[model samples]
Target chain A: MDRDQANYLFNVMRLDQGASVTLFNGRDGAWRAEVAERGKRGGALQVAEQTAPQRNPPDLWLLFAPIKKARTDFIVEKAAEMGASRILPVQTEFTNSERIRQDRLQAHAIEAAEQCGGTFVPEVADLARLDRLLSDWPEERQLMFCDEALFDRPSPLTNGDATSSGTGTPWAILIGPEGGFSDAERSRLHALPFAHPVSLGPRILRADTAAVAAMTLWQDRLGDWTAPNSDPVR
Target chain B: MDRDQANYLFNVMRLDQGASVTLFNGRDGAWRAEVAERGKRGGALQVAEQTAPQRNPPDLWLLFAPIKKARTDFIVEKAAEMGASRILPVQTEFTNSERIRQDRLQAHAIEAAEQCGGTFVPEVADLARLDRLLSDWPEERQLMFCDEALFDRPSPLTNGDATSSGTGTPWAILIGPEGGFSDAERSRLHALPFAHPVSLGPRILRADTAAVAAMTLWQDRLGDWTAPNSDPVR
Candidate 1:
C-alpha cells in the first residue's frame, strides 16, 4: 500500500507530499513511510522496512449483545484497542436491535487498529443467536460473564482466585444488552460448567462501560501485565 | 427533580403522562415515579420509593484531563454510573481545552444517575491545575495515576500486594488527555509520595476507556465488590 491509497491518506488524514505517515500491512508489520509524490486525485509513497513486528494479541474474546449504533461502534473500537482476539455480537432475548452493519463495524475496528498501532485487527464476527452460541460453546475456554443482576456476589476473576494472583487460562468476557439478560438466559449461563458469572460490582454499567470494565479485569488477571523487561534492539 | 426537568424525556424520549420513570435524589435513594401531570410546557410526577439503598459507593474520585465535548460528557456520565463520588477536571501540561462548561458535564452526571438507578450524584469539581491538585492532595488519599508512557514496567496492579491496596483511604484515578502527560508532569507524578503510577496494560486505551478501566480495577480490589450478594427485597 502506498500514498496513492487516497482513502486513508488524502481523504482521512489529508496528508501532502513529503509528509511522514505510519503504515501497517499486518504481515509486513508497521512502517514509517514518506509521501514521495502527490497528485490531484492520488499520491505515491516510498515504503520502508518494518518498525515493529506482528506480535501476539491476548487470547481475549469480547462477546456482547449489540446496542445502539454509536455505542456499538464505541464498543467495537475499544475492544480492538484493548487487544481482543475476536469480537462477537450476539442476539440475546433482550437485544433491542437485530440488524448490524458488519462492514461498518469492521471499518471501525480497522480504524481503531490504525490509531492504536496494533498490527492485528480483531475479527468482528457476524451476529449469532445467543442460545445457539451457548449450545455450541467450547468446553476448553472459560467465560467471565458480567452479570449485573447478580449484585450480591463477588466478581470471580478469570484465574478463579479472589486475590488477583493467577493467570489461569484463555478466556472471553461477556456483556449483556441494555435491558440486561432475561432470567432464563441468566440461569442457562449459570448452569454452564465453563461459565463464571462475575459482577461488575453493585452498580449497573452501561453495555459499553461493562465491556471496557470486563476487559480490564481479564487483562489484569491473564493478559500481558509486564512491560518488556529487557532493552530493545532499537 | 420532576419529569418535566428531563430534556431528553420531553424532547428525545417523548414520554407522556402516566409514563413510569425512575427518580433519584442522590441522598434519599431511587424511586419509581409515574408522570402524574403533563402540559405543553411542563410535566410533574408522583414518586414512590421502591428498592432501598442497594449498594454503598466507594469514596473514590475520578480526576481526568478533559478532552472533546462529547467524550468529556461521556466520561462524566460513566463515572457517575460507575459510582464515583467526585469528578474533577484537571488542567495538565497536555490538556487541550482549558475552559470546560461545568454545567453541561454536571447535567450529564445527573442524567446518568437517573438512568442507572443511582441515588448518589457524583459531585463535579471546578477545573484545577494539576500542580495545585497534587500540592493540595490529601495525605490519607492514594492516587492511582494511569500513566500511558510507563510501557517498560508492569502495571501497578501486577505488583499490588495487600499492604499497598487503597482500602479504607480515599482514592483518586487520574487519566491523561489524548496527547498524554508531558515529561515534567510525569516526573512530578513519579515523585509524589501518595501517587502510584499504573499502566492499563500493553494496548493504548483512549482517555475515556482508561477512566472506566482504572475505576474498574480500583473498585474490584478496594471498593464494594461484595455488595451484590444480598437478596433483592422486591
Candidate 2:
C-alpha cells in the first residue's frame, strides 16, 4: 500500500495495525492482505495466499449513448454492478453530448465494483460512433436492442428459452439516447440479423432505468444469474 | 401552466408560442395542450381533448430503508418510473438515516413521472417503522424481500405460475439499506408466509441498484410487465 492508500485505510476506514483486508485486481484472484505497519502517511502490507479464484464477469457488453453527466455515471456504475463484462459509450444521432470523460466513467465503474464487492471491473471503452460500430460489428456476438417504440407494442420477447444457448454465445445490450433511436437507426437495427429488439416493459423508462432494466432482464434470462458458478467461494 | 412553468417551457425548453405539449394530471388522463399566449413571465395553454385514458400503475409497492439523500431520491424516482404504485420508506435496525424528507422525495417521484411520460404518479408514503408495518401486513399482498446474504446461495424463487393469481393480489419489493438486514430481521422475514426471500443475482449490489434490480426482476417474473394492460395508454 502507498501513502494515500495507507492514510485511507488507517484513518478513513479506521483499520489498525495487523488488520486483514481483502484485495483483488481485475487479472489476479482475490487475496487477503494484512497491515504490516501503521504510519501517518505510508504503510506496508503482508500479502497472503489467494482466497478466491479469478472469475470473469458475463460476456455481455453494454453499449449506450452518453446522457447527462450524473445519469451517464449512474449507467456505468449500475452496469458494472450488474455484471456487464464491458461498457461502450456510443455516439448516436440523437445523443445530446458529443464528448465524454472516459477516465471519470471508468473511475465510477471502479468505485461501483469496490462498493459492490465485485472482483472483476468492467472496462469502459472510449466514445465510438454508432454507425462505425455497427458497420464493423462482430458476426458472432448478438445484440439485444432496446427499442423505446416497442414498449407501446406487444412484447415480442417470450421468456421461453432465450438463454438456452448458454453462456458460450457473446452478447451485447444496446440502449439509445433519451430522444430514442431515429427512424433510420431503428429500422437498420431491426433489420440486422444479429440484433434482437426487446421491450423492457409497457412503461416509458428513462434512459438510465432502461439500461438497468435491460441488464436485469438479460441477466435473468440469458446471462449467468440462473447458473451458479462451481467451486467458487464468496 | 403557471408562471414558473411558463418560464421553464419557453426559456429552458425553448418552446415558442402555439407549441403543442402533452399534459397529464393522473386523474384526467393525458391531454394535448397548445400554447395560447406566450409572455416573459407567464403563458396560457388551451387544453384539448384527452388523447389517452387514465392508466393505473402496477399494484406493486417498493419498501426501502432510506439511505443518502441523492440515493433516496434516486430510489423514489426509479420506483415511480419502473411502475411502482406505492413507495414506502421503512426503518430497519441497521438503517443509518433516522429521518427523511418525505416532501422532497415525493417531488422527486412527481418529477420522475413527468420526465418518464407516466400518467400515474406513485404516492410516497411517510416513513414507517418496519416492525409496526409488518405487524399489520395485509393477507393478500406478497412481499419480495431482497436478501443480500443470499446472493451467494441458490435462488429459491420459482417463476412457475407465481403471478398466475393475477393483479388482484398485491405485491411489494423490500430493499434494505447499505448495511443490509439484520440476522433477526432476515429470520423474521423468511419465516413470514407472505414474505418471499429472493436473491437478485450473484454480485452484491448497492442499495439503489438493488432497488432497481429487485423491481425489474419482480416486474419481469411476477408483475404486470408480463401481462400488458388493456385499453389504457401511456
Candidate 3:
C-alpha cells in the first residue's frame, strides 16, 4: 500500500488526513494505520503495531463456471469476501468464455481483499477444462456440488455426519452456469464418492445467487460462524 | 401480456414468430406463450391456459439502505429472484440517498419477475426514515436486523432457531449501507423487542451479500424451499 493507494482509498471513503484506517499484510496480520503525511497528490500511511494475529483461513474452494465479465468479477469478489481459500474458474460445456481477462479478474479479487480486510487473497486459477479438472481431481478433498438437478435433496448443511471428516480435508463448492451442467458432467459428478450434491431449495437460483447461498450454508455448517467481539485486524 | 408486449420480449430474446415463451399473470399463475404473429416492428403472443397456479410468495421483506444506482437495481433484481414479497429502502443516519428513483427501481423489479418466472413482483417501497420506520413497525413482524455491533453473534442462518414460529409471518431483513449504521441507529435497533440482532458470520459481508444471505436463511427456515420440479411458469 503506497501513498497513492492510500489517497485512492481515502477518496473513495471521503476521509481526511490523520484518520485511522486498518491494513493487513496477509502474513504479519492486521495493523492500525493513520495518514502519516498528506500532500496534494497523495498521502503516506503510518502503520503501527499489529492489532490482530495472522489467522488461518478455512480450506474452502469456490469452483464456478465463468459467466459474463461483470458477473465473473462479482463472483470472484464475493468469493474472497466469503473467505474462499481458492477461486477456480472451470470451463464447462456452457461456459461462455474462451478468452478470459485473467489480470483484470485478479485485480478485482485483490481490490476485494483490500476492502474486506482479508489477510489472504484467494488464489485465482486460470480457466481450466471441467473434464480435465475432474479427471485429475484429488480424491481426498470433499466436493460440495451445488447441483441444480437435485432440488429434492435436503441442504448439505443438514447432514452433519457428512462433514465429519476428522482430518478436516479440503472442501470445494461447484456452481454451474446459466444453462447448467450437461448429462455427462452431472453423471461424472454423481459417480464421485466425495461429491455431495446439495439442494439450494426448489426455486432455481441464478449462478451468482447459488454461489453466495452455498457459501453461507457451508459457513454455517463447518466454517467460523461466530464473529469476535472486536475485529482482529493488523 | 399482449401481442406488442410479446414482440418486445421476442425482440430482446431474438425469437421469431411461433417461438415459445413463458408468461405469468400473478393471479391465474404462469402460462405457456408463443409468438402468434409478427409485424414489421412488434409481435403478438397467444397465451394458453395456466400451466401453474399462483404459488404463494414468502412474507419476507428486504429493507436495505440503497447504494449506487446499478447496484441498487441489482439488489432489487436479486431480492425478487430470492422470493421477497416486498422491498423497502430506508434512510439511516449514514444513508447517502435522500431521494430514490422509485419507478426505475420498480421497472427493475418487474424485469426481474419476468426473467425468474416469478408470478409476483416484489413491491419496491419509497425511501423511509429508519427511525420512523422502526417507530411505526408492526409488532407481529419479526425484524432480522443484521447487526454489525454484535460481532460475536453467529450468522443469522446459524444463530436463528429453526423451529421458532414455523407458522409463516411477515418478516423483514435490514441491511445497512457501505458505511454501515451509526451508533444511534444501532442503539435504536438493539432496544426494539421485535428486532432480532443477527450476524452474517465471521467474514464481513458487503450490503448486497448480507441481503442475499439473510434471504437464504429465511427461505431455508420458513419460506418455500421445495425444488421447482414442475415448470416455474404455471
Candidate 4:
C-alpha cells in the first residue's frame, strides 16, 4: 500500500492485521482479503478464497449523445451501476458535445462499478458518430429507441407484447441529447427494423434521468432482472 | 427582468423586440411571452395566453434517507424529473447525512422540472426522522419500500398482483441509506400494512440510482403513466 492508502486503512479505517476486506479486479469474482502486515509505512493484504462468483448483467448497451461534462459523467456512472455491458457515446446531428475525454469517463464507470458491487466493469467505448454506428450495427442486436414522440404507443415490451417482447436478445438503449434527434435521424431510426421505439413516460425526463429510467424499464420488461408478472400486462 | 436577466436575453441570446419565450411559475401553466422593451438595465415581457395546461405526475412521493451532498442533490433532481409529487429526506438509524439544505435541493427540483418541461414542480420537504414520519404516515398512501434484502421476490407491482398493484392510490417510495436500514427499522417496515417491500434487482444499486429506478418502475407498474399493456401479463 502507498502512504496515503496505508494512512487510510490503518489510521482512518482502523484496520488491524487480521481484518478482512472484500476485493474485486473486474475480471475475477469478488474475493476475501485480510491484512497480512500492518505498519506505519505500508500494509500487506493476503488474498484468500473467492467469496462470490462473477455475475454479469444481460447483453445490454447504452448509446447516448453526449451532453455537458457533468451530465455525461453522470450517464457513464449510472450506466455502470445499471449493469450495462458496454457504453457507447454517439455523435448525432444535434449533439452539442464535439468530443469527450474517454479516459476520464472510463474511470468514472470503473468507480461506479466498484460502488455498486458489480463484478463486471462495463467498457466505455470511444466516441463515434451515430451514422457510423448505424452502418456497422450488429444484425441480431435490438435497440430500444426512447422517443417521447411515441407517447401514444405502449412503451414497455411486456410479456403481452408477443411480437416484440422477445427475451434473451442482445439489446441496446439510445438516449438523445437535450436538443433531441433531427428529423432525418428520427426517420431513419423509425425505419430501422431492429430499432424498437418506446416511450419513457408522460412528462419528459432529462437525458441523464432518461438513461437510468430506460435501463430500469428494460430490466423490468425483458432484461436479466425479471419481475415475473403472473398476470402479464402487455 | 433583472440586469443580469436583461443582459442574458438581449446580449447573450440576441433577442430583440417581439421575441417569444416560454414561461412558468409553478402554479400557472406554461405561457408564451414576448419581449416588449429591450432596455440596457432591464427588459419587459408581455405575457400571452397559456400554451399548455397544467400537468402533474401521479400522487407519488419519494422518501429517502439522505447520503452525501452530491447524491442527495441527485435524488431530489431525479425525483422531480421522474414526476414525484413530493420528496422527503428521512433520517434512518444508519443515515449518514445529519441535515440537508431544503432550499438548495428545492432549487435543483425547479431546474430539473424546467428541463423536463414539467409545469408542476415537486416539493422537497425538510429532513425528518423516519420513525416520526412513519408514525404519522397517511393511511391512504401506499409505500413502495425498496429493500436490497428482498432480492429474490419479483419487485414490480405488476397487473397480476391485484392486492398490492392497486391503481390510483397515493404512493411513496423509500430508499434506505448506504449503511442500510437497521434491523428494527426493516422489521417495522415489513410489518406495516401499508408498506410493500420491493427489491430493486439482484445487483444492488446506490441510493441515487435506486431513487430513479424505483420511480421508473412505479411509473410503469402503477403510476399515472399507464403503459396500456395490451396483453397484461400477470
Candidate 5:
C-alpha cells in the first residue's frame, strides 16, 4: 500500500490487524480482505474470499460533445453511476471544449463506482473527432442518436432486447453539445443505417441533464432495465 | 420590471427602446414584447404577438426528500426542466435537512425554465412531513413510489395511460432520501392502493438521478411522452 493509503487504513480509519475490508481490482468482482500488517507509512491486506461476482453494465458507450468542465464531470459521474460500460468524449462542430482531462475523468468514474458501490469502472476514452469516430464506427454496434431536432417526439425506442441476437451486441448513445449539431453532421447521422434517432421528451434539457435522461430512456427501453437485479443505477 | 431586470435589459444587455424580447408569465403562454421604455433601473415592454402557447407539462408532481445543498438544487432544476408541474420536498425518517429555502429553490426552478425555454415554472413547495403529505394525498392521483429495496427488480410500471379514466387523471413520483426509506414507511406506502412501487433497475442511483429517472419512466408510460412534441426533455 502507498503511504497515504496506509495512513487512511491504519491511522485514520483505526483498523487493527485482521480488520476486514472490501476491495475491487477494476476487473470483475470485489473481495473481502483482512489487515495483515500495520505500519506508520505502509500496510498490507490479505486477500480473502470473493464478496461480489464481476458485474458490468450493458454493452453501452456514451458519446457526448464536451461542454463546461463541471457539467462534463457530471456527465461522466452520472454515466458511471447509471451503468455505462464505456465513456467517449466526441468533438463535434459545436463542441465547446477542445480537450478533456482523461485522467481526471477516469478518476471521477472510479470515485462514482466506489461511492455508488458499482463493481465496475468505465474507461474514459481520450477526446476524438466526431467525424473520425463515425468513419471508424464498428459495424454491429447500434447507435441511439439523441437528436435535438426531434426534441418533442415520443421516444420510439421501446425494447433493447427486441434487437437482441443473443450474441450480446453492443449499443451506444450520442448526445450533442449545447449549440446543437451542425447541419452537415445531422444529415450524416440521419443517413447512417446503424444510427437510430429518438426523442428524450418534450423539454429542452441541458447537455448534462440530457445525458442522464437519455441514458434513463435507453436503459428503460432496451438495456438491462427489466433484467433480474444485478446492477444498481444509484 | 424590477431594478435588476431593468439593468439587465437596458444596460447589461444594451437593448434600445425598440428591441424585441420574449416573455413568459408562470401561467400559460410566451409573448414577444418590444421594449417601449428603457430606464436606468427599470424598463417597460409593450406586449406584441404570442410567440408560443402556454404549454404546460402533463399533470405530474415530483415529491422527494432533500439531500445535500447542491444535489437538492439539482433535483429542483432537473424537475423543472424535465416538465414536472410541482416539486415538493418531503421530510422522511432518514431525511437529513430539516428545512429548505423555498425561495432559493423557486428561483432555481425559474432559472431552469428560462434556460430551457419552457413556458411554465414548477412551484417549489416548502418541506412537509411525509406522513402528512401522504394522509392528504388526493384520492384520484396515482403515486409512483421508488423503493430502494426493489433496486434489482424489473419495473412493473408499463403504461401510464393504461388506467385512463378519461378524466385527465393526475400522477406524482416519489423519491426517498439518500439513506433510503424507513422500513415502516416502505410498508405503509406499499399498502396504499394509489401507490405503485417501481424499481429504477438494479443500480443504486442517487436520489437526484432517481428523481430524473422516475420522471422519465412515468412520462414514458402514463404521462405526455406520446403527445405530439410540445415540450423538450432536452
Candidate 6:
C-alpha cells in the first residue's frame, strides 16, 4: 500500500493493524487482505485469499466524443457501472473539448467499479480521432451508432429486426457530442456496413442521457439483461 | 408573460422587443409568442399562434425518495425528459431527506422540458408519506415497484409474465432511496394487488441509476417504448 492508501486505511477509515479489507487489481480476483503495518505515512498489507472470482462484463465498448468535464466523467462512470468492457473517447468533427484527461477518466472508471460492486474495470482508452478509429474498425464487431436526427425514424431497436444483432457477437455503442455528428461523418457512418444506426426515442435526450438510454436499450435486446445469470461474456 | 420573463429576454437573452420565442405552459401547446415590451425589471409577451400541438407524455408516474440535492434535481430532470406524466417525491421510512424543495424541483423539471424540446412539463407532486400515498393508490393504475433486494428472483418483467400489466392501463414506477425500502414497506407493497414488483437487473444500481433503468425497462415492456409513434398514452 502507498502513502495515500495508508492514510485512507489508517487515518480516514481508521482500520487497526490487523483489520481485514477486500482488494482487487482488475486482473486477479478480489482478495481478502489484512493490514500488516499501519503508519501515518505508509502501510503494508498481507494478501490472505481470494474472496470472489473475477466476473468480466460482456465484450461491449462505448465510444463517445468528450463533452464538458463533469459530463464526461459521468459517462465514463455510468459506462463502467452499466457493463461496458471498454471506454473510448473519440475526437469527432464537432467535438467541443480539444483534450481530455485520460488518467482522470480511468480513475473515475475504477471508482465506479469499486462503488458498484463490479469485478471488472473497463479500460478507458486515450482520446483518438474518430475517422482513424473507423478506418481500422473490426469487421466482426458491430457498432450501435446513436443518431440524433433519426429521432422519429423507425429503428431496428424498436422493430423486431433487432434480432439482426445476434447473440455472441462483439458489440460497441457510439454516442456523439452535444453538437452531434457532422453531415459528412453521419453519411460515412451510415454507409458503413457494420454500423447499426439506432434512435433512443422520440424526444431528444442530452448527450449523457443518450448514452445511458442507448446502453439500456442495447442491453435489453442484445446484451446481458436478457439473461444475466448465464451471461455469455461472464 | 410576466415582468421577470421580459427582463430575462431583454437582459439575459438580449431578445429585442419584437423577438419571438416558443412557450409552453403544460396546458396550451407550444406557442410562438412575441416580446411586446422589454424593460430592465420586467417585460410583456403577446401570445401568438400555436406552433406545435401539445404532446403529452405517457401516463407514467415516477415516484422516488429525494436524495442529495443535485441527484434529486437530476431525477426530476430525467423523469421529465424520459416522458413521465407525473413526478412524485415519496417519503419512505428509510428516506434520508426530511424535506424537499418542491418549487426548486419543479423548476428543474421545467428547465429540462425547455432544454429537451418537450411540449409537456410534468407536474412535480409535493412530498408525501409512502404509506399515505399507498392507502389512496389508484386501483386501476399498476405500480411497477423496483425492489433492490429482488435482484436475482424471477420477476414478471423477465419471466414473460408482464402481461399482467394490461395494456391501456395507467402505470407508476417507484424507486426507493439510497438505503432502499424498509422490510415493512416491502411487505406492505408486496401484499398490494396492484403492485407489480420488478427488478432492473442483476447488479445493484444506485438509486438514480435504478430509477432510470426501471423506467427504461417498464417503458420497453409495458410503457410506450414498444410503439413510440402510436403510443397509447401520447
lDDT of 5 by residue, A29-113 (tens): 8899999987766789999999988777788899999999989999999999888889999999999899899999998998899
Q: Every model's Cα RMSD, please?
A: 4.3, 3.2, 3.9, 4.9, 3.3, 2.2
User: Residue-wise lDDT of candidate 1 within A95-203, one digit each (tens)?
Assistant: 9989899999998998999888777788899999989988998776778888887676655563444224334456788899999899999999989877888878887
lDDT value, candidate 2, whole model:
0.83
Candidate 6 per-residue C-alpha lDDT over B112-213 given as tens digits, one digit per residue, 9 for 90 to 100? 999987888889999999999999998888888988777666543655445666657789999998888999999999999888887666666778777777
Q: What is the DockQ of each candidate?
A: 0.64, 0.58, 0.52, 0.47, 0.66, 0.50
Which 10 successive residues of model 3 chain B have the least lDDT summed?
A: B225-234
What interface RMSD, in Å and to 1 decimal, does model 3 have?
Answer: 2.5
Q: What DockQ score does model 2 reach against the true complex? A: 0.58
lDDT of 5 at A199: 80
DockQ of candidate 6 relative to the true structure? 0.50
Give the winner by TM-score: 6
**lDDT (Cα atoms) of all candidates against the true structure:** 0.80, 0.83, 0.78, 0.83, 0.84, 0.82
B123-192, model 2: which lDDT tens digit per residue? 8999999999999998878888888777554443464334555555778889998998988898899899
User: Which TM-score value belongs to model 6?
Assistant: 0.93
Name the candidate that leads on lDDT. Answer: 5
DockQ of 5: 0.66
TM-score of chain A of 1: 0.86
| Candidate 5 stretches greater than 4 Å from native | A2-4, A7-18, A159-167, A229-234, B159-167, B229-234
Number of clashes found in candidate 3: 10
Give the candidate number with the greatest DockQ.
5
Residue B175 error for model 3, in Å? 1.1
Which of candidates 2 and 4 reaches a greater DockQ? 2
CAPRI quality level assigned to candidate 2 from its DockQ score: medium
Q: Native-vs-model 4 lDDT?
A: 0.83
Q: What does candidate 3's lDDT look like per residue over A21-81, in tens digits?
A: 8787667778888878766666777887777776645778899998888888899988988
Model 5 chain A: ten consecutive residues of lowest lDDT: A159-168
As for candidate 3, its clashing pairs are A30-A233, A30-A234, A31-A234, A202-B226, A202-B227, A202-B228, B3-B44, B30-B234, B51-B234, B52-B234
TM-score of chain B of each: 0.84, 0.88, 0.85, 0.89, 0.91, 0.91
